[model samples]
Target: MTRGNRILLSCIYWAFVLYVFVPLLLMILMGFKDSKFIGFPIKSWTLDWYLGVFSDAEVVSTLTYSVVIAVLSTLISVVVGTWIAVLLEGRKFLGRAAIFGLTILPALVPGIISAIAFRIYARLLGIEPGMGAIIWAHAVHNVPFVALVVMARLSTLPKSQIEAARDLGADPIIAFLRITLPYLIPAVLGASIFCLLLSFDDFVRSFFLGGYEPTLPVLIFAKLRSGMSPEINAIATVALVLTAAIGIWAERFTRRTNKDAKP
Candidate 1:
């Protein structure tokens, strides 16, 4: 690219980044403001909102529930998705395309529609709308993502490795555990983190599935309806920081693993 074109591209990229993050920056700034409402031109700054957010029993309980659900659902999705990917690898069977299409259909479907369907399904199954329902729903939605990532990883793996292991007297399970699983660890972890973040940030599915109970996103939505407050801002800031930290850690770990795998 020419120097002028490169500069134009750089400017456009930075402008997009600013557009995306400016509101978040403003929100974080509002968290530290002493004003009663979320507004610009901060008169003063204090940590009272942060303190209040941490001290509120409702906030604490809701956050704890969200964290638990996101973690558990992500873990379950990763395990089940990995197994599914392994089973489907190198298979040339009838309905393979249909199976893959069905697996990812949930992701392509509108979230609100999925939420409504899940609500009706839960009701028909006599399941109460709560943490249990939310976790299951989130896990179902995340499984396809995990499966796709894992399948891609498996595709790149050398078939000879597993074949050689089998030739050396290893059973199917033993060969998979010893040879295939190791190569998939990084992709699995990356996909797990993606699932966790998706579940954590979800609003509509959690709203329908949680019913009386509320996750952090649901709580934020409720609070927004009432009116913006520094307490909400404080909670959002903490959540943002936690998510960023986890994402950075996941990326670093994946990069290190990839480097170690290099010949």
Candidate 2:
């Protein structure tokens, strides 16, 4: 491209980066402010809020609760999504298009709309608003993402591997277990991390389906009602750090696994 075009693109990239990260930087800075209120001209800073997050039994328990929900939902999504992906990938059958569309419909729907639908469906099914409901909703929402990732990996898998396994007198199940599953590990791990972050960060569904106990997001939302404070900022900052760390780790691990899996 032209030099002017390159310069313009570079400027735009930096502008976009600033736009995205400035707010996050400000939030993290506010978390360190010592004042009770949230604003500029912070003359002091303290770790009380950060420390309180760990000391507060409620926050600790809510975090643990969120982690449990994310884990359960990710497991459910991985199994169901991988199975559907295997069934549909490179296979033509009656109603295959319909099935594929239905599988991914949850991901395509807007979050608020999907959450409302799940809430209504739960009530109609006599399912109480609680952990089970949240897990089910999150798993449904996450399955499409898992399926897409797994299918992408599956597309790259060598057909010869499956044929070779069969030629060795391996049954379909044995071939899948010995070859397909191993090949899909990187995709599965990546999808699991993605689903974990999505479930942990979810707010709307948890809000609509949660029982007496709240997830971390729900607890944060509840705190927001009182008003924004440094404490809230600290909570959000901690969560941001955690999710970012997980994402970075997943990226690196997936890349390494892909390299290792290569011939």
Candidate 3:
């Protein structure tokens, strides 16, 4: 590459990085501020805000609710998505491509649009909002993403291994268990994590579908109506740190697993 192109690429990359992380860095800084309000020129540093994050009963309850929904939906999404991927991989049937497109379309839809659509449908059908509704919404939203990721990994696997095993008199189920499931493990796990995080962080569907109890995002929105507080900053900072830590761990784990698989 030319030096001019190199410089251009470097500039673009750093710009994108700054676009994503600069605000997050600011939030982290605000979390440690001594003041109760969010602002520039932070005067002093303190951990008092973080210490108070759990003291709020509503926030804690909503956080737990979010965790429950995220976990339940992730499990459902991963199982259903993996099954769909397994069935569709390198297979053709009438309307197969249409089904594939439909599944993927949900992930591409704006969350608020999907949430509103589900809300209208649910009300029409008289399905009251609750944990089940929120979990169903989240699972439906996340399935396509999990399917796409798993399908991509599935495509890279050679077809001959399964065929060879079947040709050697092993049952289809046995061959799949011994060959296919083993190969798909990493992709399945990574997709599960993706689904978990997506469901956990989702706001729109949860906001609309949740009943009696609100999730963390919904709670955050309610609190933000009064403007950003030190407690909010603390929560944001903790979330950022945890997300970054998990991302780094997942990347390292993937790398190590891939490296160990090599001869």
Candidate 4:
């Protein structure tokens, strides 16, 4: 209520914002600067770095690989995860808790650990690491997240609708398609976007499971280790812009959903 309190709150909010965004902002700026190395006092500005991104066939292919995997993984995670949530939430069965925990274990485990596990599993199955392996890892990693999101939405939903549908001569399948699936549509969509981003930006798992084909993040890491290249900054700038845009859209959707849920 006091002016001092308001000023303090404003300061804290700005500080948090800067802490989160300043690094990203710097990377983007460095992308445009003419300097070969990322440092202060950018002497010039250029769009050449961005053009380099399109000019390099390797970069283009890497980006394409990232998008393909992200989309495939997102689709798999959404369908499977929505089902997992619908089954597990508010249900009692033997070993239910353990199943739930195991389903979400990939999300809790470190990326390096998951990568190592995937490598071993792939070798055992006689499947080499490549697009398929990366896609599988990504899907497994995203399922728990999508399930958690959908389950949270489901928790706020009433079971009576499905019951009424069943009572009115509808089978379980029809009731689900008509009553349950429709209700969970928004959550499923939001979770898809979330999972897509997770897959797109993933580095460690993709690095290990990618095999001969490298994703965008893998390319970026290689560039970093190789030498100073403004192209890395340009790619990072694009990634940050896309990530921020998706994050903002997700936040807006959440706020709107909350508002709609209000009585």
Q: Count the backbone clashes (under 3 Å) in each candidate.
A: 0, 0, 0, 0
- Identify the runs in model 4 with alpha carbons over 4 angstroms from their true place: 1-6
Q: What is the C-alpha lDDT of each candidate?
A: 0.91, 0.95, 0.84, 0.89
Say which candidate scores most in lDDT: 2
Compared with the true structure, model 3 gives a TM-score of 0.91
Off by over 4 Å in 1: none
Ranking by TM-score: 2, 1, 4, 3
Q: What is the lDDT of residue 182 in candidate 2?
A: 92
lDDT of 1 by residue, 111-192 (tens): 9999998888889888899988999889989999999999998998989998899999999989888899989988998999
TM-score of each: 0.96, 0.97, 0.91, 0.93
Model 3 clash pairs? Answer: none
The sequence of per-residue lDDT tens digits that candidate 3 reaches over residues 79-138 is: 999989988889999999999998898888887899998888788878799888899889
Between prediction 1 and prediction 3, which has the larger lDDT? 1
lDDT of 4 at 172: 93
Q: TM-score of the candidate numbered 4?
A: 0.93
Candidate with more favorable, higher TM-score: 1 or 4: 1
